[model samples]
Target: MEQDIANFMLRAAKFEFFLVNRDTSLVHTKVVGVFTAIIGVNWTKVAQFVEVAFPFNTFDFTNSGFEIFAQTAPQYLVIKHDGRLGWDCDNEPIDSWDRLLTRSYAQLRNNVAHGNKHQMPAPFTHDRTAQFLPAGLALMNFIANQVFLESDWDTPIFS
Candidate 1:
């Protein structure tokens, strides 16, 4: 029931839990290389998914792309809307969909792995940590529905 293979594949692929206590900085800056392993900081896949889900990249980037839209706001919540269109932000995300398409998880990864890693800007502080865990776990299950739920793929992720 532990699903050792599943766990190994998850870890091997470089996906980290980034749990608050153990390795929270993976979400931002200040990471220990050996621990982050292979997954690196490239959220490109997630960003790509976001773009497909919300193609316009038209969300308000007025005050740094760090703003988290309400959970009810599907248009902004799902995609990586940062780095698309902004001037006052601390870092660069892709701009046009075409640019985002070519953007890999480079800056954060490159900085952390190669040169001096700058401290990242402020993080998402809105949600409760308790809520964060279940949501993330649900996301994992969403991707691995077949593997985790077997034929019951339609079952609710958290429920």
Candidate 2:
């Protein structure tokens, strides 16, 4: 289910890019308004859903998990760590999947919201359509593999 949501988000991002690239007239204030709303509201909602599934709550605030998961990780970890610093120090190295997804999704959202609607970037040449497509697809695959594939809801919640 999480994978499906990520896929849908990727497709939506791609479609928005395609539409803006094909029709300059379509790039009006209204479109930018909608883009801002999507990034600010929709993306955050998706991120929260991802958090519920994966629950990166084993790392400290200084770790990548806290940075990516925000307050949730520290709050959850505190229950087991009991104010001890050794909790994160002793655990096996966890992959920084949440950080990667958070950063990439934020960038994709910014590009959609702020990239010049009237002018295409040099990377996105007049004829080339593949340049910006990878970010969307990569994010989708990352979310699918990291959050959905690895999550075990049957495991006990920390808090």
Candidate 3:
């Protein structure tokens, strides 16, 4: 389990390198958003393609933007919804993880993939970057530490 999480974090770190090296501005934002959703799919049972099935302690993943774990899959996701904030999955009409993803990373990913790159955070700002990039990276970093105490993830070198 520890090794699996470390491997996942290594991949996530590679993505970070790509983001820092190849992407900038809205492109960077787009990359970050996509990366964020990827992280979501891996962390939660949201998507199955890159699904990471390690022994994750639900207790370690509660709150902090994640829905409280219900057995395995999360019961809900914490994100801004409607004209206000907080939208419960049961009360809303969400057919996919789009509505429940953290910071609407799925939405940004979908929007970019579909060529509707309008209203994006315009890069150079956390609006798009904050949309997920840092949070996802931080989450993965945290999870990595939780999984591997001796991991030197803090001193990442893109090489």
> What lDDT tens digits, residue by residue, belong to model 2 across residues 82-151?
5532111122233443443344444444444444323533432222222233444544544445544633
Ten-residue segment with the worst summed lDDT in candidate 3?
68-77
> What ordering of candidates by lDDT runs from best to worst?
2, 3, 1
Please count the clashing residue pairs in each candidate, in the order shown: 3, 0, 1
**CA error at residue 65 for candidate 3, angstroms:** 7.0
What digit string (tens of lDDT, one per residue) describes model 3 on residues 40-148? 2321222211123333332334554333112112123235545532213344432233233322434333323332213332233223322333345444444445433
Candidate 3 RMSD to the correct structure: 13.2
Q: What are the clashing pairs of model 3? A: 126-130
Candidate No. with top TM-score? 3
Off by over 4 Å in 3: 1-11, 15-131
Please write out the lDDT profile of model 1 over residues 1-159, one tens digit for every residue: 124333423432333332222233424344466564333433444344445545535744333222222121211111145644211223354464333322312221222233211232224422322232333334434323422232333333252
Q: What residue pairs are clashing in model 2?
A: none
TM-scores of all predicted structures: 0.26, 0.28, 0.29
Better of 1 and 2 by lDDT: 2
* Ten-residue region with minimum lDDT total, candidate 2: 70-79
